[model samples]
Target: MAYLYYGADARPAEIPDHVLAHVKVVAATKLRRGESFMLTWRHRGEGTGGRTSLWMQPSIPLRFVFDEPEPEALDSEYLRKLANEATSSRGIVLEWDDEAIVGHPGEAPPIDAMAA
Candidate 1:
């Protein structure tokens, strides 16, 4: 499965509902705005011998996926909720590094690189 990483905070599971909603909104807005950007993150862990962490950031091209597109109207309440969520998220600001290995499914490639 493909994964989306939010680097600023580095706590994926701790994202609040409001922030998630805002992310969806931001993604949708970016798609509408014709803006595509790369998000990167790092993974750290300890193996049998020692501790290690790798900085592997991937660049992804995101397109708007609309089953039923909504009108280009921004809901104030929703926007506020999203803003609050983003504030709470406090995600880290990561520099863009376009060096990620794409991974594919149904074929076992390297255990590290994932299909884009």
Candidate 2:
């Protein structure tokens, strides 16, 4: 699991390491270009039963903590899809998906292709 800490609030949003990794890339790209967006996610655990959205900007302090020692390979197609969602009216939504860690919406290349 990974945690994304923003602002002075002690409670950080917990996400999977792989998801957070992709989010980091997408967010950094947007922030670098001075774009702000809302990031929405369903709150898990006791006492937090609903969804929450945060306004992400370049000015806010953000921190990402990952439990994994090494970073995973990024899927460009997945990143593009995420970025598109973030810019849309619905905004970016983070969800828990075990399959997303390896293969996402786009087709995953064959093992032989990866070796090339």
Which candidate leads in TM-score?
A: 2
- On a 0 to 100 scale, what is the lDDT of residue 18 in model 2? 64
lDDT of 1 by residue, 1-116 (tens): 12234445343422223222334564554435554433222432345332222232233333222233432333344444333433343322221123322220122222221111
Give the Cα-based TM-score of candidate 1 against the true structure.
0.27
RMSD of each: 16.2, 5.0
Error of 1 at 11 (Å): 10
Question: For residues 1-116, what per-residue lDDT tens digits would candidate 2 score against the true structure?
Answer: 89999988889888888678778887887887899888988876668788889999999999999988877566666677678877888878887654454336654432211111
Q: Candidate 1 — which residues are off by over 4 angstroms?
A: 1-14, 37-116
Which candidate gets the maximum lDDT versus the true structure?
2
Go through the candidates in order and give each one's C-alpha lDDT.
0.32, 0.76
lDDT (C-alpha) at residue 39 in model 2: 91
Which regions of candidate 2 deviate over 4 angstroms? 46-48, 97-103, 106-116
Clashes of 2: 0
Q: What is the lDDT of residue 61 in candidate 2?
A: 92
